[model samples]
Target: MRVLMVSWEYPPVIVGGLGRHVHHLAIDLAGMGHEVTVITRRPSGTDSLTHPTTDERSDGVRVIAVAEDPHEFRFGTDMMSWTLAMGHSFVRAGLRVLAGDQETAWVPDVVHAHDWLVAHPAITLAEFFDVPLVATIHATEAGRHSGWVSGSTNRQVHSVEWWLANEADALITCSESMRDEVNRLFGPEEIQVIHNGIDVDTWPFAPRPQTAGPAELLFAGRLEYEKGVQDLLAALPRVRRTHPGTTLTIAGTGTQLDWLMETARKHKVTRSVRFVGALDHNALVAAMQRCAAIVLPSRYEPFGIVALEAAATGIPLVVSTAGGLGEAVDDGMSGFTFQPADVAGIATAIRKTLDDPAAAAVRARRARDRLTEDFSWREVAERTEGVYLAAKRRVRHAYGRPTIIERPLPERDPGK
Candidate 1:
């Protein structure tokens, strides 16, 4: 099958977990005897405008890059950056198609778009070609529980998300929890739940010597209010009271970093909490192995990939029962889930793990086994391919013939 995979970003240009997920899925699909052409925005750099770049045969996958507007790639607190990037991506993809390059002549049998950021272009292209479109909603606005956003931003994101689900042949989400959410919010749409997977080999398995008497708790990923980072900080004071030497390691940088740090100081827990800032994969995995257990205090998570990463490393996870985190963690088996925003609950869980290091080790082993058997990339790839095949079948039946789709053209050409 020929597949056109659309994502806003890719490796060497990751904005979030979604980029890494897309990169792996494409590679695995190609390995399974499917031809995959990834369409993504070129990273901002000197090579941003050198026409189409091809990543030929890496892990048996072929990737095609179509450069997008560099200005829209700015990263910050503005949520609109993603929406604007999607708009430009559509224009750039359209231009590439019109250029009539033989290198990209094989139009996709099915279009798989990841997240709301690239849904606009994916929907337009699928409609233009009358092909089946499948959208993977990594997260949702309602899940974030954010207060009202700008009218334009809200409407734009909501419209694209809704249209993608309504127009696409089927919808894909990372967990059964997300499947239920999409169904409840978007009416009865065909939704498939594909849990996120990790490369076990990539994440080293040997357990590092646990942090001494003062247990170190690690939290990695974006630092945002919705992520419950502030709530975790609030829990630290109590955690320290029980385990006097407990040290919390907070990694990653975000809009809420200053406030989070200030809150730690206000509670005089700054000495107990170490703000490690953002870390590369090597450092992150090392931290994960060394920590007693990984804590994810997300208000709502679609699928706690970080939990899977920790579990893959033979480390127990304490995650919020909010959203899909519950599904990823098996309470008392591999890890435990607590109610969202309960600082006391988080602290208590930490203390329990610290109380019996041996018991905690048993749980960590269980978590690692679960990840190895169920969530490896090979298994994930096979399941994802099932969705791609289903989408391909849907497109074939709907169009009755092969249909070639391209992104929408811009109203005005800036290059001119």
Candidate 2:
């Protein structure tokens, strides 16, 4: 299969799990003998003149990156316009690839879109090439806000997500919980659940040594309200009451950094809390090796891929049973799980993980064992391949793919 993947974030510009998810999946798919191509943006600060737009990775994936337009538009303040510009860049790069030498012209059998961010280009490429568009709704705007689309930007993003979900030939999500959320919020339809994967070998099992001073608890991923890091902060004082030397190291960065710092000061746990901001993946893995346990207190996680990475490294996990996290860590069986945003519950789970060394080690072992069967990239790619085939079958039944459709946008109520 000649698979063309569309994602806003990719290697060297990873903001979250979506970039890593696409990175691993594409490489694995190519390893399995599929011709994989990824269209993404050049790293944040550089342009095409500074960085090579076409990267032929040794892992058998061809990456064609685009430079943001030389405009005075900031993504934060001008998202709609920024997204349009990015989409235009992606389409241009894709068309260049498709319109190469007649003898070496490249064509993709399917266009797989990562999230709503790349929906415009994915839909355009799929339609222009007459191929199936398989979209993965990583998360939804409504889901992030706990079923509320309040701001104008929120509503705009939600509408685009709906358009992508409805327009795609087949839909996929990172978890069963997310599949339900997508169907409920968008429209009733079948959406495949493919949990985000990790490279188990890259994350070798590194059991923490017993010679510890303060009990170190690490929280990875972006620092945001929906991430429930604040809840973790709320539970810290309670955790320290029993384990006085317990320290919480907050990794990653987001809009809530200042607020989270203030919250720690408010809780009087500032001395014990360390804000290390964002670190590269290698550094994060090394810190994972040193920490007592990886804590992910996500209030609305579609699927906690970081937890899987922690599990793969044989690190004990204390996560919340929000969305796919419940499936990722099987409570007592694989690390520990508490309800989302449960302050008291968060304290208890951490205590439980620290209270028993033998039990936690056993659970960590169980998690590591589950990696091959559950979270391996090989398994994820195979499952994704199945989805591609299913999407193609759906398109075939719909009277085949059309090379071109010069139809105008249908009139509809935006509020609906």
lDDT of all predictions, in order shown? Answer: 0.74, 0.85
Model 2 residue 353 lDDT score: 92
Can you give the TM-score per candidate against the true fold?
0.87, 0.92
lDDT for predicted candidate 1 compared with the true structure:
0.74
Whole-model lDDT, model 2: 0.85
Instruction: Write the residue-wise lDDT of candidate 1 on 154-267 in tens digits.
Output: 555655566566667778899998898777656646788888888888887766465556788899888877788777888888888878888889998877888888888877
Segments in model 1 whose C-alpha atoms lie over 4 Å from true places:
44-57, 70-82, 94-104, 146-152, 208-212, 392-416
TM-score of 1: 0.87
Over 338-368, each residue of candidate 2 has an lDDT whose tens digit, in order, gives: 9997999999999999988778888999988
Q: How far is each candidate from the true structure, as Cα RMSD in Å?
A: 7.6, 6.1
Off by over 4 Å in 2: 393-416
